[model samples]
Target: MICYIYDGSFDGLLTAVYESYYMQEKPEQILRKEHFLPDFFIEPIYIKTSKEKAYKVYNAIKDKVSHEALKYVFYVFLSELKESSTLIYRYLKIAFKIGKDINLHMHNGIVLSVHKISNKVTNEVHRMLGFIRFKFLASNLYYAAMEPDHNILQLIMPHFSKRFSSQNFIIHDRKREIAALYNKEKWVIVDMLKADGEKLFLNNNDEVYEKLWKQYFSSITIENRKNRKLQKSYMPERYWKFLTEML
Candidate 1:
């Protein structure tokens, strides 16, 4: 069995795919460096990420495959599902063979798997878009923190960046240990693995806003019309921790 190991970036995954096709050796599994387990029987090949190689593969997908196929590839990558690397490799293999109609071939296992994972990622993005609540910080920034199941910070940043273009903000993904920092002019993602959440500078007026919001939420709640199950279905319990009213 052959295992291809790479850095955890999407570009690195594409580079691994490029190497596999170039070497004419298909790997049984493609794993990130942290996930690769050593085995005497399995041949492990470490793949270095190359921008040129990754760009080539990306261009091929864009030029040869349909735009929808490229979109699916990105969405599936963002899904962060187990064995997503191998799934993407297999999906691309079949995609290149079957042409632009590959997505239409739902009977194909790889195609179906990619489609399902992409749906999961899309759902998570939509949920985050609705669930995210920002708090005014003492630093004059709007800050929000969340621990989404998938790596969707990048996917959802554009929405907030556009809506709050005039203000500076930070969207911290606790699970991923990363933060999307947006200034009034532009935005950038930063590694915040060691960031102290407790040190977040909250505005003095935040408490007043929180109290007012919670009171408004309580006033609007209809005791007779309350449906816990339905509410949970719409807004998962996990997200309530970051919501001001839920707090």
Candidate 2:
């Protein structure tokens, strides 16, 4: 068994895939460097991230395959699922052979798995678009915090960036210790772990809006028609911590 370890980045994974194809040595497993553990029986190969190699593979997929297939590849990577690198490599092998029609091959296990993982990540991105609640901070920046199950900050940024194009904002994914900051123009992601000392300074009037939102939420709910189970189905409990009305 051979294990290919790479830096934890989409480009890095693509580089590894490119090397595997060129070297004619497919790996049994593809793991991020941080997560890779030595196996006595398995030969471990460490892959360095190369932008040139990554770009070559990326362009091949985009040019040879359909753009839609490329999008699916991106979504699957953002899923951060276990052994997703291996799954992506498997899906790509078939995708390259079958071309754009690979998406229609639902019977293929690798294709189906890729579709499922992509759907899961896309679903979370949709949920975050509606559920994210931003607060006005002391620095006059709109700030929101989330603990999403997937690495979706990049996926959801374009929507919010276009919607709130004039405003400066930050969406912090506490679970991943990363934050996306928009400066009324373009957005960028930053490392924001607890130890980073990046404080969120909220204005005094922030509490006023929070109270008003909570009050409005309560007023709109029909007491007799309240259904906790139904509400929970639409809005999971995991997101309650970031929701002002839920607080």
Candidate 3:
């Protein structure tokens, strides 16, 4: 079993997939930087981040499935489950053989698990769209920071880019130590701590948007009809960091 270890980047995972076939050996498992490996150690092959090969795999999936399906695939990739890459590898491989019905294989645990995770990522992505609080700092760049347990920032960018098309914004995932920067027109994602925190959390951009947002959030509460229990039910305190009303 060729165990492929990745550099904790989705691109690296895709590259590993390419290497899997090229190596002519089926991988027993795929893992990221922080995950534990099996007790029975196999030679761990680390795949380099190859954008070209990554796009090759991306196009393969996209050509077969709809763009929305591709998004779901990426969402599944973002799941923090231990066997995520292994499952994704299995899913994508079968996708080549079965086409769109790959998702319909609900009886298959791996496929089902990925579908469930895709929903969670999508839900979190939508929630973050409304939950994110941007601040304007010294450099006039807008920035927001979060440490989502799941990797959902990339999935949240389009929502912000569309809604705030005229403004510049940056989102940092403290858990991943990566950030996405949206210039006026386009968006680019990079490692937050790669060089400096110029456009990261506590960067050159911080304003009172958070305080204002919290104030407005508090002001809008209907005191008479406030149902603490129901509010908590709908928007649990656990997800408060990703909810404006709770922020």
Candidate 4:
């Protein structure tokens, strides 16, 4: 069984998909290198990231599945699942062989696995819409930082861009170590290793806003009826670190 390892980028995943299809030999499993190699006898194929091949694979999928299906694949990739690459390959192979209705194969093992990953990433995408707090930076650029469990900056960009069309901003994902920067007219992403952000007001430092937010939070909590477990389930403790209301 062939074992494929990727750099864990969407383009990289796409390139790997392109190679797998061209090679006509589907692998036993696809894994990210963050985890150590399994005890099994492994034949490794290191997936090289190439935008050209990536775009070709994208067109191949778009030829079979609707654009919406591609979006679902994007969300699934954000989940960073170890088996995501293989599952996407499986999904695409079936999709291309069959027609558009092939999406009905959602119940298939690979398709279902991909949906699970998409669901998790989609949930995080929704939460970051509300939980993220933007700080005013010099040059009129409003900025916020988060260490989201999923790679969701792109998912979160359009919402803010459409709503705040006149503003310039940046949303950094400290975990994935990338940031999306919007300059009022267009949006672009950059890695933090190349960023110019300093330790300046990285967290919103308004005392009054913090106090008012805290008061509102306390006021809203029904002490006697509070279900801490339910609250924690919805808003995990890890996410609270970057939320102003929680701070």
Best by lDDT: 2
1-247, model 3: which lDDT tens digit per residue?
5788888778988888878778867688888867846566586777677989988988888887556557766787788777788888887787778786677778987778778888887777766666676767676677777767688877788888898889887887767788889988999888887335443444444446667877986888778988889977655466676554464
Judging by lDDT, tell me the better candidate of 1 and 4: 1
Residue-level lDDT of model 2, residues 127-222, one tens digit each, is 999999988876788888898989999989999999999999989988899999899999999999854424665243557778889999999988
Alpha-carbon RMSD, each predicted model: 1.5, 1.6, 3.6, 3.1
Clashes of each: 0, 0, 4, 0
By summed lDDT, which 10 consecutive residues of candidate 4 come out lowest?
Answer: 193-202
What is candidate 4's TM-score against the reference? 0.83
For model 4, the superposed segments whose C-alpha errors exceed 4 Å read 24-26, 33-40, 137-140, 193-198, 202-206, 218-226
What TM-score against the true fold does each predicted structure earn? 0.95, 0.95, 0.79, 0.83
lDDT for model 2, on a 0 to 1 scale?
0.88
Angstrom error of the Cα, residue 198, model 2: value is: 7.8
Q: Mind giving the per-residue lDDT tens digits that candidate 1 earns over 141-201? A: 7788999988999999999999999999989998888999998878899987636544685
| Order of quality (lDDT) | 2, 1, 4, 3
Evaluate all candidate structures by whole-model CA lDDT and list the values in order.
Answer: 0.87, 0.88, 0.75, 0.77
**Which is better, 2 or 4, measured by lDDT?**
2
Better of 1 and 3 by TM-score: 1
lDDT of 4 by residue, 2-110 (tens): 8778787788888888888677666776666674386567788888889999998788677767776787788877777666767777777777777576667877877
